[model samples]
Target chain A: MSKDAFRARLEGTAAAIESLLDRLLSSSPMPGEIARPPRVLDAMRYAMLGGGKRLRPHLVVETARLFGREDEGVLRAAAAVECVHGYSLVHDDLPAMDDDELRRGKPTVHRAFDVATAILAGDGLLTLAFDMLADTPTDPDPAVRIALVLALSRASGLGGMVGGQMLDLEAEGRFAADGKPIAGSEEDTLRLQAMKTGAILAASVDMGAIIGRAEDSQRNALAAYGRALGQAFQVADDLLDAEGEADLVGKATGKDAARGKATLVSLYGVDGARSRLRRLVDEARDSLTAFGPAGDALARTAVFVAERQS
Target chain B: MSKDAFRARLEGTAAAIESLLDRLLSSSPMPGEIARPPRVLDAMRYAMLGGGKRLRPHLVVETARLFGREDEGVLRAAAAVECVHGYSLVHDDLPAMDDDELRRGKPTVHRAFDVATAILAGDGLLTLAFDMLADTPTDPDPAVRIALVLALSRASGLGGMVGGQMLDLEAEGRFAADGKPIAGSEEDTLRLQAMKTGAILAASVDMGAIIGRAEDSQRNALAAYGRALGQAFQVADDLLDAEGEADLVGKATGKDAARGKATLVSLYGVDGARSRLRRLVDEARDSLTAFGPAGDALARTAVFVAERQS
Candidate 1:
């Protein structure tokens, strides 16, 4: 697959995800709900609907497609992944967390709304993700739906994304008596990054496999591909923060270094990080080799992750 | 059943839930997880264990018991409910939300830990609730597991408890330009209370019904009982807040009136609120009438809600 073809597919998937999210976050109450609480609903919409690379959802959709499963259920699962991703971002940008004011070129949810609303919105989104997965529309098989929920909760819960965020905060010396940032070892950085960013990214692909009912070997292969792709994506993000212009990156740049945040880029020089990115991309592509032509889009995606400017 | 019997049963259930939560939130990581950061795990433990009436979990266990579910799975489901309840309290006590310095005669999570740790702990707990529900141990049947997940997410998400919290904030005029607390109408207060407190309480019974595989009519009766029980619980809580001593209640009292918070107690005066509580308790007991002797404990619980001094 050519770069242009991959970009078009990515963009198309993002658009579809945006539409689905809009419908999901509508002001009307869902069944079993009393009222939508418009302010929180609006904040949730602001946090989720308008923008994102939609890379996670795209991975979900494309990986499912790779396994010869194409259906609306796939899109629903994809949207569910985006909800978890979006909720994490919203909470992460709070004053108590990263304190990021801008995300994807728009004000962070806490900045756009009050802290209380932002917190509630994040909670709502996180809960809704599981709700969506358990719904029959996501998959006809109850076992499959339960599997998706279990995978997502494990990926996003204590020892995964949330734990990763906690580790990141600790590395920033938020809990230290001295209140000074402390850099971690290279191995520690790897573990932290994997937990914080890589887990959810890997789960996105893993979910696709579950939805598509992939064989154990196929699932393992996709999981390997996803892990490498996730690391590559993070390295590329760090590289963008280190080198890309703020305008192009769509958020503040060099803040990672300013915060003395532990990153692979900080341990490895820009040149070394770039080389690692290349290798991870190669590994990601290699994992999908067993799938042959069906894996082309994913292989292209690995490249796109490594080569993304923002 | 005598009051002593009910109290002993409640304490036994609470102890069981505490043990389950301790095991679930252990420092060791679960499968697929990379690592459990000690600080966050500690925070999660601090937020969850050694607390409260465990009223929600007791409701779950007893309701299931009412339908003859006596296995360990009932306790696991009950523990999951407590996780959600714990997560909500942790978040609600944040400086940005209720700014509660204490709970159950001890420091709140945010007071004991920093705001960031508290937030992450809450997130971790919330995510784990679904993980627990979807686990095979919760139910041998995937459909039952999915049903529990769907019911929980709806009860706790946008239109339910989280939405209720948002409405409560709005009623306090948190979003108003003038920054003045505004009292809501009686109807608005009812809606808000139902969503915020009643929904989860109702869900506890609904989950019991789901786990016990209750007949549709039995489920409906239990749901009605749960809803009324939930309202009675909140009204009793408000009365405690309005009139109980801080020492006996195990936390500060009269803060709601101080903050000009809307409550049925605030809308109807103490005498009126007491009358309302009695009527709700009656309604709750009435809903459980079809269950005959199995409903006796639940009926007593309603009276307990209305009459408890603390």
Candidate 2:
């Protein structure tokens, strides 16, 4: 498929996933008119329904198709991934964390509501994601479901997203364990980027494959594809941070360099980072051979990762 | 059993459970740790290992016993509960949240680490709980595992703990959902309180029962028992806030009154609060008849919850 057609496919997938999540979110209870605070509902709605690329969930639904398993089960998994993604952004923008004031061109959750409400709202969304997965129709063997839950949790937890945040925090003049600098070496930086951004993406694709009954080797191959794609995503993100317009990016730009946040450009310089990203794109494409022509969406995703400005 | 012996039994259960968690935690990789940062490790350790009373995990293990199921799988369920509880405490102490400087008479996670580290650590622990549940070896039954994950996630999430927090936050300001004064009714106060404290405690007990293959009705009974006990637990907590010696409480005492935090004592004076607590305790004990003597640990838990000083 040509790049334009591929982009169109991704956009379509994003819409489908967003609609599913919107439905899932609208179904949550409002405490009561006499007691239900609109702020809580507002915060929850803003965090979950605030539309983005829906990259994670798209990866899920598309990858599920590879194994001929596209069902309602993918919807639950999609919501679960999106919930985690939304929460990470909310928490990341908190005053104590990244403390950004804007998200997706709108005020961040803490800025929209108060700090406590945002915190609780994010917590609510995160937990609800797991609840969605846990409640998935048990047609998939219990063993498979357990593995799915495990992958989703780990992807969101210390080994993936949280672990990435810890490294980011510790790198910013905070000491690290064993007195090693939190950020050092090109390999270390890439590894951190992969775990933080890549792991969840990998989980998204790999999980869809697993749910669709893909063989173990196929799942592992997709995981490799996701990790490569995730690296490219971060590098593209870093590039946007460097040169993209804030309006197009939909949030603050140039903040990464300003905050001295340890990113690809910081460690490897612009040219070096781009060079590495090109390599990652190729690696990602190579990993897609397992899916054969069925990975057209993902193959286009890799190219988009390397070239997208935002 | 004497109170000390009873406390010891609970403590012992927690310790064994913790021991299981230690193994599980160590076995899981720290994702961002290429060489493993010490500060991050310390932060994770601080919030997780050797911290707080392992009440949630103990309840899980004990509840499993109530259902006549005791196996390695319970250990995984217990670990999941502890991880959630730890995550809550870590976030609860953040400067933006409760601003608690001490937990369990030790420096809180944020105090020990920085605010950002504490936040990520809490996030890590919370997600890790779900991951832990995914690894249960005994019951490969996805439905059982899924039930456990769903129950735990809901308890920790909005319809449960997080929701209760928003209510508590509003209550603290004496503002209802519409920015009006909260009703000064005992029913209103208990309703919110039950969702907050009661929800997760109920989940804790129900988790054990469900894992032990308890029928839905038995699970409901355990949930009711836990809800009552959990409320009693909150009542005792409020009582501590009001009447317990500051020195004895060791953690912060009277913070509820000082912060204008909403609580049973805040709404009802000491006598009224005590009377309400007595009713909850009686209900908790009465629910135990269903378990016959099998509910002995839970029944004893209710009595201690009603009478304990701290």
Candidate 3:
């Protein structure tokens, strides 16, 4: 696929997700807006509706399409997953965490709004994500909705994203004295990255498969594809941070090295990380062999993940 | 319904919920600990165990008992609601929010641990609450589990608790110029209080009703009871903050007045708030009239909510 075609596909996904989010989180007098406070909705919109690649939602859509099931339910599930992703970004940019002032080429939620509002907005978005999954509109079968909730909570909770965050913070030497690095091997760094970003990204595909009601074999294949894609995405992200310019990356660059945080690129040189990324992308594309021509879009997605500037 | 009998029942309920929470949040490999990490589990345990009246869980169990269903499922649902409540308190006490130094006669999570850990702990607990609701052990019927997830998310999300916190922070003049009190009516104050504490408390009963598969009329009646009990509990809490000693309350007192925060008790004086509290208790007891002797435990709970010192 050409760069222009991939960009068009990404923008279409982003537009769909942004509209769905606005419908769900808007403070206007919709069916559920009877009790929604305006200021909180404003803050939530700020965190959710603006701009990003919407890569997680794209994975959800494309994976569900693999099973030949595309409906409003899939779209809502995609939006739900994006909500969780957006909330994590909001919380991660807080002053006590990464302390980032900019995200996606704009002020972070905490910088645009007050700290308290930003915190509440993140909390609201996270809770709403689960709410969306359990909502009747998410799927006709209640069991599928329940399964989505269960899988997503596991992906985002103690053993996954949040727990990984705690490890990442500790690795940043915030708990250590005199900037002494914490002890961990190369495998540990990869595991940390997998847990923090890879889990949720992979879960997006898993959720799509669950909603589409794919067979176990197909589900396993998609899971493998998602895991490999997640690895490629995160490693590419680290490489961008390690080497990309601030203008292209849309946030501070080289801060990972400055903080002495552990990353795949940090443990291996940039060339080594780049090589691993290429191999992961190849693995991701190879996992969809069963789907043949239907998997071409996903294969293109892998290429986009590997080469994107931001 | 003697005081001694009620005390014994309350203690029994607390012990049961505490044990369940320990099992759920523990790092030990007792079934669901496949991917649980240790440090985040420690923070979650600290946030959840060893504090509060366990009023919410008690509400859940007793309400379910009123419908003649008492089992592990109810207990797990009870523990799940408590996790949501506990996580809210943890996040509410963060430095950017309440900035409190102590809670339940001990240091707050941020005070006990660091701010980043506290934030992650709160995030983990919230996710786990949804996870528990969707876990098969929580209910035999997947639809019931989905219903529980749906109801709990609505209670915890933007239209409910988190949005209320945003309003409460705004009422504290956190967003006002020079800390000037915002304009509002008495009804607005009560509505704010209802959204903050009342929603979750009522949600506990709603969850119980859903789990037990109550009749429509019974569910509505129990919902009314829960709402009234919530109001009574909050008014009593405000009165305690207004009049009780700090040591007796197990945390700070008179902070509401000091911060110029609006509350039912602050809007109306002590005597007025007490009268309202009595009326809400009567309303609650009256709502349970159809259940007759089966609701005796819940009736007694209303009395306790009205009269408890802490």
Better of 2 and 3 by TM-score: 3
Instruction: Point out the worst 10-residue segment of candidate 2 chain A by lDDT.
Output: A29-38
Range of the 10 consecutive residues with the lowest summed lDDT in candidate 3 chain B: B28-37
Stretches of model 1 off by over 4 angstroms after superposition: none
- lDDT per residue as tens, model 3, B131-235: 998999999899999999888888888888898888888888888879866755688777787888998999999999999899999999999999999999999
| Docking quality (DockQ) for each candidate | 0.92, 0.50, 0.65
| Candidate 3 residue lDDT tens string, A1-310 | 5668767877888898888888887665333322788887898998888778899999988888888877778889999999998889889899988899999889999999978888888899899999999988889899999989987888898888887787788787777777565766797787777778988988998998999898999999998999999999999999998989999899999988887777888788899999999999999999999989888878899989999898
As a whole number from 0 to 100, the lDDT of residue B21 in candidate 1 is 91
Please provide TM-scores computed only on chain A for all of the candidate models, following their numbering.
0.98, 0.90, 0.96
Give residue B272's lDDT in candidate 1 (0 to 100): 95
Tell me the spans in candidate 3 whose CA falls farther than 4 Å from its real position: A1-6, A29-34, B28-34
TM-scores, all candidates, are 0.99, 0.92, 0.97
Model 2, TM vs. native: 0.92
* Residue lDDT tens for model 2, B1-100: 4677778878887778767767755634744222333455568777777744677777888889877777788878887888888888787777766788
Candidate 2: where is the Cα deviation over 4 Å? A30-37, A137-140, A174-183, B1-5, B27-37, B174-184, B259-262, B266-268
Ranking, lDDT, top scorer first: 1, 3, 2
Of 1 and 3, which scores higher on TM-score? 1
lDDT for predicted candidate 2 compared with the true structure:
0.76
